[model samples]
Target: MPMPASYPTYVPRKQFTQYLDDYVSHFKISPRYHRSVESANYDEGTRKWYVKVRNVSSDEIEEYHGRFLVVATGETTDAFIPEVEGLNSFTGEVLHTTQVQIGKGI
Candidate 1:
């Protein structure tokens, strides 16, 4: 299918990442990095949620309480594919987005 002239038809991976970085920097979106999530639990009595976060560098665990939460991890990842039956009969190989090759003869 042909894309509209205003939209992009093909964009390189590095260029795409650079565009995303530029967007973040322009908008001043400072995202926290390397804060591992240990567990998330909800309390019915208080009607709030507790998230246990552990610092990746210090290994210190701290609990954060919030009424609402959104897990925004894996913004550039492909959707999860569930297991299927008779996968051995497939002729084509499966590859993730990161594993896709670009440019040249392709």
Candidate 2:
């Protein structure tokens, strides 16, 4: 049956944290401990990837090998910057969200 065109589209991540929580809950899997992924490399022979994770507190590294890799890291991890016309030439002041705020009000 043909659906109505007026039906609203359910675009996720409008409210990032809520969307992230919903996505995590949709997959009913639980892990023993939480860790941070440092890097990953593919093993062509095994058709799998070796991922390196770091324990935040002790700064210990752990490796996990798996076939499928899903990047569940949230918006806090990465940033998307658009290329503006004169962005490169303009040498005034530009800061990315990833940058740390040092001082008070500018």
Structural similarity to truth (TM-score) of each candidate: 0.44, 0.42
The global C-alpha lDDT for each of the candidates, from Candidate 1 onward, is 0.61, 0.57
Top model number, lDDT: 1
On a 0 to 1 TM-score scale, where does candidate 2 land against the true structure? 0.42
Model 1, 28-97: lDDT tens digits are 9776678988876666678766889998988999788877544554556665443443335534353444
Q: Report the C-alpha lDDT of model 2 over 68-92, residue by residue, as the tens digit.
A: 6544435555664555545476444
**How many Å off is the CA of 15 in candidate 2?**
3.9
Specify the poorest-scoring 10-residue window by lDDT in model 1.
97-106
Give candidate 1's error at residue 24 in angstroms.
Answer: 1.3
| Regions of model 2 farther than 4 Å from truth | 1-14, 29-39, 70-106
